[model samples]
Target: MVQSLNSNVCEERVFSNIFQTLSKDVHNFLRYKYGDNLNPKDKVQEAFIKLWDNCKNVSPEKAKSFLFTTANNMMLNEVKHQKVVLKHQQVKPKHYTNETPEFIMEESEYMKKYQRALGNLTEAQREAFLMNRIEGKKHKEIAEELGISRKGVEKRIYGALEKLRKEIDGI
Candidate 1:
């Protein structure tokens, strides 16, 4: 019937709108909360699928909350399983025999200083810096992930760099 077809079209449009609005937010939320343990993209996709499946029961206003909660619960279950695996594993140390003792000692000292500096940074600055530098994310990507302006991301990264330089130079 035409009525049934119209209802289906409306439901599809609503689902599409929800996906566009909350997919990135949900992905970033999972990634930020769980760090590297959870695959955020996968979690986002799974959450959206569940939302689509339960579209009749979920309202537009509540879709965001439902997606986030579902993704979080999925991540928590994954973390629990990972914890079990990690408990049974032994971590190995990396060795470099080509470097001189003095060079190695100096490098170690510098790394320690760097870590201390990083630890002293504000949470925002540290998160922005790590995402940009260590994870190879661009300023725009960092901004999106942190839900801030691109300029804000740049400022945080620059501030972190300046603080680190001062800390390391003073050491």
Candidate 2:
């Protein structure tokens, strides 16, 4: 088949050639700019799909530029969405309960103190205590997981409990 110099890239062979030549370059460009956490491969694939969608308007000479621009724009959109999600996550929503407002306020205040007390505990104590209480693991189970003796786990839990009780009243 004879191809003109200014022919569009709607042909199968032309599109495939463009994908083969530019996919890796576009993928590496995105990965280097934004880590793999942003799914650069997905962006690259989406960009090529977009290029194929608009292939009638994209000439073979312009395919590389179109792929790179489209890929970069897609990644920017994803990064923007991630930032919005993270921003929303940092905000706490109000809760609806049957308890009185005063009781709920006091409960919220106590919860704040409880969290502070948990943070005040030593890292070792906090880890073991959380594994036992929050995760519902037995002392022996926690000891095995943490590579410590059962007695050591018990001591950490005890110390954590003692510190928590002192720091937060009515815990």
Candidate 3:
């Protein structure tokens, strides 16, 4: 990127130049590979991160090749992972509860309300509650993750649940 620059890709000016020169091409390449399902921007960033991590080893002449190779390998790995997930899904038994249309509509409406109420909660309360219930983490684990006391995590979760119940159940 930096014309006639030294071999050190780690240099801030050289690295910035490289990013300015290659980011668009890299992003376009990734987007062409995955139009919507996957995040091409994330892939570009990850590729750049790999290049930065190996800056000491990668020469300016070889940086482009290294990035493309790393990105291609990552994409292949993701494709393989998706295939495995699809295979598992195919093998897994499917179950359905065919409730009445009226019931389904009512359930959907209730879910809208529930989502709105959930979003209305304070950020701390929602984070702790979701970490505990959705992630199945213990109060102690949530505390450690949030860098707060167990009591604090408990309080946030309790407050969230109380608000949700009141909003959803009209209690």
Candidate 4:
């Protein structure tokens, strides 16, 4: 038990040292990706927490890069998601104002169809679609999160969009 405790302490020391070194670059990269929308400091804390939780697998030498990659990915995902929600919210109100009752009903029906089409997609396809179309994520970022190649991400997103457009047209 004492030996185990000592090993844990050693891990903590390594994590602390590495976190201190990488926190700045991680913050800067997150800031660049997410802009002023999210707190870079909070992202650093989250990254450190993840590192601490995964300390067993992480070597001291790789800790800095791991922290940077983890934080950047998390922040990018957050930004992409928030932007999608925001875009939907923004679009809904503007189109409502100039329409008649019939037009409003038609628009709502179209939205329902769109939502249904979106729902019918496979999880990966839907995510790729949203990340590419709604969130504007690059193929590389989507690939990183989805654990696929950049080309795969691009193909999935394209395929999803093509299907969605066809479904929408039928409606």
Candidate 5:
């Protein structure tokens, strides 16, 4: 009975080792490609979860291939989602430098009001606004660097603009 138990434990250890080795390779491959787009840690977690769910059917030899395929599909889905979201965001139209403004006074007033409003904002809000507007960072990038949510960055920018508009009206 002791010999039989030892054999069973050895078999289990071998199976566990195989899964671990294959999963590690799969994570490395995905990290090389999509590391910048999605968190590598999250992708690895998802791959392991799938492996766990399908472990009974997945043979040791085929496990690596399965993990790679699953990780690739996940990265593709993330890329497609980001593309759809970015496509919907409206970009400001570019004007030629030679194009003459019909009213310079309005532009000056707007700048003055915007500056005053910016001065009144909280330090975090002002920093976020400047990073987005003056420094030209995407909301996602700003959020990551500032350690804030994307929605928070969006809110700060919108709030800043609204305050500027109100200040202009008061002027």
Candidate 6:
């Protein structure tokens, strides 16, 4: 019957639509749950295929739940079979007390040069840089406090950095 044929076509369209819509969401969900080590795309594909095979029993509304459940179970089985290895690394703390006289002189000179460079920056640039670096204010916070746009704050900070780099490099 034409009605039966049309119904079949409609059902296929719904299945295809569900696959396209839920595939990305299902992939992201799996990726978030299992991390980047597992192949989420493969899981998504397998889930959709399972959904297609059982399309007779699943409505379009329940398709999302079915896909997520299938992907989760697949991921769990994969995780269970795999051995988890965690490597611990010890980081050595830096000690600053072992400086030679030449090193101390060089560090002091660098600080003086840095101060000179800060003195050379434009007032706007200097204020923005200090607020960001010294006062530790975010761009948005500095922008609000200075009555400037975020972009303006960013430009000022960038300009200050460029000027300081040039001065410090002796260019």
TM-score of each: 0.45, 0.54, 0.51, 0.46, 0.43, 0.43
lDDT of 6: 0.83
Clash counts per candidate, in order, are 0, 0, 0, 0, 0, 0
**Over the stretch 85-144, how does candidate 3's per-residue lDDT look in tens digits?**
999988957566679889999889998998899899999999998998899999999999
Error of 3 at 74 (Å): 1.0
TM-score of decoy 3: 0.51
Give a tens-digit lDDT track for model 1, residues 1-171: 113332531287767877887888998899899886578899899988888888777677677888999999999888998888787675666666888999989999989989999999999999999998899999999888899999999999999999988888854
Q: lDDT of candidate 3 vs native?
A: 0.85
Q: Which candidate is the best by TM-score?
A: 2
lDDT for each of the candidates?
Answer: 0.84, 0.92, 0.85, 0.79, 0.75, 0.83
- Scored by lDDT, the top model is 2
lDDT of 3 at 117: 94
Off by over 4 Å in 3: 2-5, 94-171
Candidate 4 residue spans exceeding 4 A from truth: 1-10, 93-171
Q: Give the TM-score of candidate 1.
A: 0.45
User: Which pairs of residues have clashing backbones in candidate 4?
Assistant: none
Compose the digit string of candidate 5's lDDT tens values, residues 68-163.
898889888888888888887756566666535755667787787777778998888889889998899999999999999999999988888777
Q: Residue 33's C-alpha lDDT in candidate 5?
A: 88
